[model samples]
Target chain A: MNRLLAATLLSLVSSPVLACDAVQLGTIEVEQAWSRASIGTSRPGVVYLTIRNAGTEDDALVSIDTPISGMPMLHETVVTDGIASMPHAMEVPVPADATVALEPGGYHGMLMDLTQVLKEGESFPVTLTFRNAGEVTVPVSVQGVGATDAGCSENNG
Target chain B: MRLTRLQKALWVAAGLAIVAFGVLVTIMNRAPEPAAQASFRPTFSLPDAEGRLRTAAEFEGKHLLVFFGFTNCPDVCPTTLSEVGQVMDDLGDEAEEVQPLFISIDPERDRELGLAEYTNAFHPAILGLAGDQAQTRAAADSFHIYYEREDTADASGEYSMSHSPALYLVGPEGDWLRQFTYGTPASDIVSDLQSRL
Candidate 1:
């Protein structure tokens, strides 16, 4: 390229307006992730994790990413009339500079199709990809054996 | 440090023997307990299938047989509900004294209409209880219930929850009574409930 063209390109690439901008990337903070102990039989499991807004801009959790399973979804567990129902949570709101928690029976990352049983004393990595917070991976701790009250003490029969 | 060839061979043989012994032991181990221990009854506050909040006090005057399940539950929930319904029917009027409550552990999708429709399939008066996380947990806690949300990928390209399958029996005062095995017969259950009653 000619000297004039090179100078112009350099000026554009190294523009002063593009330098020292903190608004380029949003910051995110993830809290501890844990789940009840895995049961021996084919029991259910839930993974709990917290996502904090560490930036000034508004953001939302568009989706969750997991490497251990084919698909990771967001779901809410509700009880109406006298039945327990679970429905998909298409999008979890993580307002600007706010935190959204994924806990039991709430907004949690529903890992579909476990490649392997979630055995006790063992943890596998799962990633949550947020709309603004990006993606963060965590090793969830499974709780409660075939136990229904997820975190409560066992009934010693 | 390197081990001698003989030492390596011995170690390998020992490892193989241990592996074989482990396999033998695993095979000898009997089947795991199908249901959780039901040493005591539990209390909870959840909405009935009609969408009305229900507390353990709703049946404080009589025995309560509570099971955590959902309307949409294909095999486990329906089976347990039907069996319990049978046990209730076998009890005749005594079954009236022993209130049978079906509390949905999968509350998110089990709304009032859904619960009513699903529960009515098994038997009338199989009261369904559905609550939010906090209310559901409290009720489950009283019963010492255990359940978790297992994610499943659906064909339509979404995920579903797989939860714990268990049943509980609370006393007249809403105290933890006992839990039944998944395949427990109605006869045995009626007998157990009669003894308690």
Candidate 2:
């Protein structure tokens, strides 16, 4: 019926809204988690998703943790020399009452040496530790093995 | 009628010029010129998901669409490969003429088995290429591609890469061809390949 009402209903059905009481800084929510399938002689894959910050104070995502791989790291994508080059994780600064997206062709998390192929219709837990806010566990949805788009036909796209 | 015969000639010339202008306009309304062809097709060797070595040179004399990215790349990597897959489908049998390559920038982890497995998830023709950093860098430089690592640290004291997203069109000669921007439709890629054929 209204904008607020619609946003509320959509969040409930799909993306779960996460905001904690202690930080007073903000809440970071992860959704639509996915990784590319292992390719040609390579066993490990990378994971991607959005880390939305919903709060009143500035939010900085310092690190990410996942058990599926030997190591979990955050990264940002850059293009140089007509190539895609990623160096390291950027301090994702989510402004007060705003959201920062971690989508395809951009910044995402790196999941290395996965225990197994992250299957679709299944989800895994990844704990994100914020500089100001403590650790928050988010269930990452393992998208289809063939899923290409970061997310099309959905808001993530 | 006071004018001379030469004056009459001048009036006819003016009329001819006016008609010629109209004809020029009609000619200008013809179809547009086709898109440009790729400069050259470049080739490199990288491991697959199963650790098998495949070379771009091996696919020579065939239409090839290769993209450079890493398996650790969750979003752009898959999207670009998927787009290449879509282009392959668009070509149907002609798609066989074009080979799709999924090259990884993150050679640190995208060894033989990882690369092969990652690429297999997409189209079979879509091969994944990976090598040691030294080899990968040489390949990247030859193709005029660029990539760098971002500083994303996890609990295990490690890093990740954040690189560019590029789709290179390598011709039969293993030279660099043209490229499509991100989000380009498969139909567009197919159309380009058709012209090359």
Best by TM-score: 2
lDDT of 1 at B139: 72
Best by lDDT: 2
Q: Could you estimate the TM-score for every candidate?
A: 0.44, 0.63
Two-chain DockQ for each candidate model: 0.02, 0.36
Best by DockQ: 2
lDDT of all predictions, in order shown? 0.60, 0.65
**For model 1 chain B, the run of ten residues with the poorest summed lDDT:** B30-39
Candidate 1 vs. truth: CA RMSD? 23.7
TM-score of chain B of 2: 0.72
